[model samples]
Target: MADEENRKAVLARVHGKVQGVWYRGWTVDTASRLGLAGWVRNRGDGTVEALFAGPADAVDRMLEACRRGPSAAVSYTQLTL
Candidate 1:
């Protein structure tokens, strides 16, 4: 699995206005559309935690989109990529 070996993985924590918003849904949709694989969930520290695995470029794009989260995210979202 050369592709798997070359795949990139990241555990990202998103902060600010992420909880109670459609961030998870948006993330699932976006990640799936980007052909990435990952799992996202709400953390006790009021942050969104996610593990993304895919091409490096796609992962970077996902991280960028996370920074500019869904419109539902009231406050500014800061994605810790």
Candidate 2:
């Protein structure tokens, strides 16, 4: 198993047309496949918020994937924490 200290967790807010798309579902599937633990939810301000936690590399990969969500034109991703 990877070192627990090597893991990373982040809270991010995705911008653009992320709503109504399958971004959340895609995130869940992608994150799950990556063995990540987190949750994704839609914000009222036309954005999507998600928490990703897992191996550093896996989390990084998930962040990259969020840049271009499923069928969603992502403008940018903001890491809150």
Candidate 3:
């Protein structure tokens, strides 16, 4: 178990060409590899919604990866909650 005091959690919505491009799959794989606890899904507005929970450093790395996603053509506008 992670130390809850050091754990970080974020809920984010990623926008721009994130649908139908294996974004969710990539996210699942990446987050799992990072040992994060989270869920990801697509929204009706063509955005991807995700929750990331783990070490702060890992979460930061995940957010950075999300900025580029799986393709160079992909763009992101992340809103965190």
Candidate 4:
């Protein structure tokens, strides 16, 4: 498939009080809901890193969701495609 047609990968580094705040779980849930394939993990630096591979639009939406994560989270960054 053409590069543009192929699924894109989104690498995100979320900051603020993200760790231990259900950020990863929220990411997993949101990605799953959007039919995305990837994983979210807690970083040693108190950040949350996630990789989302799927349609560009879905990935973008997921990133936007990351910007305003769950009630316990305070998103500070979202590096996208």
Query: Which one is best on TM-score?
Result: 2
- Residue pairs in candidate 3 whose N, alpha carbon or C atoms collide under 3 angstroms: none
What is the per-residue lDDT of model 1 for residues 1-81, given as tens digits with 9 covering 90 to 100? 887777798888888889998899999999999899989999898899888889988988888888888988843445444
- Model 4 per-residue lDDT at 40: 87
Clashes of each: 0, 0, 0, 0
Q: Give a tens-digit lDDT track for model 2, residues 1-81.
A: 459888999999999888877888998999999999999999999999999998999999999999878865655799998
Better by lDDT, candidate 3 or 1: 3
lDDT of 4 by residue, 1-81 (tens): 765696689899999999878888888999999999998889899989999999888988998899999999988766855
Off by more than 4 A, model 2: none
Model 1 TM-score, all chains together? 0.84
Tell me, by lDDT, which candidate is best: 2
lDDT of each: 0.85, 0.90, 0.87, 0.88
Model 2 Cα displacement at 65 (Å)? 0.3
lDDT of 3 by residue, 50-73 (tens): 999999889989988888898732
Is candidate 1 or 2 superior in lDDT? 2
Per-candidate Cα RMSD to the true structure, in Å, reads 2.5, 1.7, 2.0, 2.0
Residues forming the 10-long window of minimal summed lDDT in candidate 3 = 71-80
- For model 3, the superposed segments whose C-alpha errors exceed 4 Å read none
